[model samples]
Target: MNNDEIKAALTSKSRSAKLERRGKIISFLCIALIVIAVFAIFAFVAVRGIATFVGTKVTLWNFLSKTAWAPGTTDASGVPKLGALPMITGSFGVTLLSALLATPFAIGAAVYMTEISPKWGEKILQPVIDLLVGIPSVVYGFIGLSVVVPFIRNTFGGTGFGILAGTFVLFVMILPTVTSMTISALKAVPRRYREASLALGATRWQTIYKVVLRSATPGILTGIVFGMARAFGEALAVQMVIGNAALMPKNLISPASTLTSVLTSGIGNTVMGSLENNALWTLALLLLLMSLAFNLLVRWIGNKGAMK
Candidate 1:
């Protein structure tokens, strides 16, 4: 070959190799960016929620076991503690009550929409549910302030800041989450299961209850768990109606607060980097661990059920 042709061929091959190397580098950078982004997000969550100090001594277990959550106590005789039994109890109390109230209604509504309703009816009703979900949490808080608080206050003896008030509002908020999940789960159930049950002379209700519901139980449970998690994480509306009292609730009518509520209240209570600050940070870590453990438990149960 001529010198000119050989030189051109060599240059062309070099250009192709350089382009290939550039492509690999770009691909590697993209993957690295994604990995870093995910790690940073999770690391931030873990730091605030898991790494914060809840106890300086061997007091975390004691604090959780104690009923009173009085931090920064007034008297010199009485040592201040971060016992969070009240807030923990209040949060779970409201969450369980709200989920119980919301789940059945949401499931029934979802079933009706998916099974009984005509196309036009579904189109009408679904939007209303979606609209409810779309409403801001702050607006829900305002509604509790205007309507729910007064009703609870008048109907019961105490101020409208109690577990019942929070649970009531939370019930309304959680309905959308449960309903949407139920609809998706029920719709995902295999039609063959329902048909086989029907062919065996079962009524429509019987087939749905025995076969379709059972088959879709996994998804349904997932939805319920997710709804409960959302309710537990809720702060704005619950705090709005929950009276923000740091005491343990004696009755559903008594004003109460939760861990999130206490955290919010503590923001301006002390100097930054003080003991009180460290204690609250510790509490923050505890709360994060509690939530993470609950989510893991849900997944573990799901896996067990799937294995069966």
Candidate 2:
């Protein structure tokens, strides 16, 4: 080809390449913008809720670890305590209860579904468990109210709505999530490993107990963490079964409110500036921090596993 013809073709190709790069850059920016927008909405809502409760200014020590938790007062020394310690304890208690209830069954279900189930178990039982995931939390609460509370009240007597009832409801609520995540995580482990273990004379149960479960530990823990987060946030269903009292529960059968239920029921009351209200926001910020920490930890752990 003549030099002029070659130059003309090269210019045309360069222009097309430039346009393609620009298109990709634009697409990437659009996706990033969408992600940022979503995070922004959550951030904005959380901040607004805090401001409505915490007021404009904040102190260093009080902001960090004050446990008093009463809201409202014009004075800086008015003692707008967050009562974060007890609330955190309660949240952890409930989460622990749910997590303990969930782990064994979820792991078993996942193991059976992937490692032990027959063809019919895989096809039929898997679908049923999957279906259970679609059930609403409120329905679970209703069931808890009708059968669980009555059982508790009848067996245990008065103060029927208590931590145990709420815990039971939470246990049921968190199960589907735990089981589904566990199943998916276990399934994600390499099939080749299982086969190799069998070739090496490892029994099916041993191969799973030793290799598959070990590899999927991080993923399974992630599911448990998610369950904890969900249980921490659960209010309506818990409130229905947990008595509305603010006092610390003496017994599993005694009535008491969770941190979530307290925040919900407290805000609308006339005690807007009460220590309780301010404490609620403080507890909220702590919860937000907790959730963020869990997500970050999950990411870090997942990345660490991937690196290995």
Candidate 3:
């Protein structure tokens, strides 16, 4: 090649390499910032949470197992009542109930979309599900407060703010999430699997039950876990409907409170360094841990499915 041409080619290569390196550096910096922010938050919450136990010398057993939760007041023994059992039970109650109520409907909708009527499901239901997912949490809370709460109060013979109301609201909110994930799972099944099942003299329903759903079981479970996590972490909606009373849930219609609801309600009322504040931070740490556990469960399910 001529001198001019060779020099031009070399210059172009050098510029391209510089741009690539710049892009890599930018991407790496962005990732690093995200990692640092996550760790910072975890560390801050942990320090504040542990301070409650460290400063007050509250036994972990009493904090987790006792029922009284008057963080601002001390009993006759001169110890703060920081029990979190009521909130823990309430959180689990709503999460499990809502997930159970939503799962069947989600699976049915997903089956219809992926197997029964793909054309109609794609054209109509997909947009509807997308719309549901996009609606804000506040709107859902308002609707629950206005509609579901009143209906329960009138029909169920109680004040209406309770676990049952929270369950209904959460059921609706998580339905779209579980449905979308199930659809993706069902669609991921190889077309050959369906064909082979059919060729083996299986009916469509049998094929779906024995093959498609069986294969998608792990994905469906992951979706349900995600839904449960969403329900567990929900604050404002549950707060509006759950009566805000930190008591053990007596029944579905009894007034109660979850960890998120209690945190949202009381966090602003306490001083920054008070026992009340530290107790709230501990609740926040518990929420973080539960979310982490849900993610780990999802990963385990995925790995098991892969191995199978």
Sorted by lDDT (best first), the order is 3, 1, 2
**Model 1 Cα lDDT, one tens digit per residue, 1-308:** 99999998877757678899999999999999999996876566555433324434425575676665555552344545666788888988998999999989988888788766737657977998899899898888889888888998899877777999888888989898888888888898777877888889999899878887777787778778878888888888888989888788999989888877778778679665665665566666666766787698779867965885
- The better-scoring model by TM-score among 2 and 3 is 3
Q: If both were scored by lDDT, which would come out higher, candidate 2 or candidate 3?
A: 3
lDDT, model 1, position 100: 94
Enumerate clash totals for all models, in the order shown.
2, 10, 0
lDDT of 1: 0.79
The prediction achieving the highest TM-score against the true structure is 3
List the candidates' TM-scores in order: 0.83, 0.79, 0.95
Ranked by TM-score, top first: 3, 1, 2
lDDT of 3 by residue, 116-215 (tens): 9999878889998999899899999999999999999999988998999999999999999999999999999999999999999999999999999999
User: Which pairs of residues have clashing backbones in candidate 3?
Assistant: none
The residue ranges of model 2 lying beyond 4 angstroms of the native Cα positions read 1-9, 13-26, 38-82, 269-279
Candidate 2 positional error at 44, Å: 3.7
Better of 1 and 3 by lDDT: 3
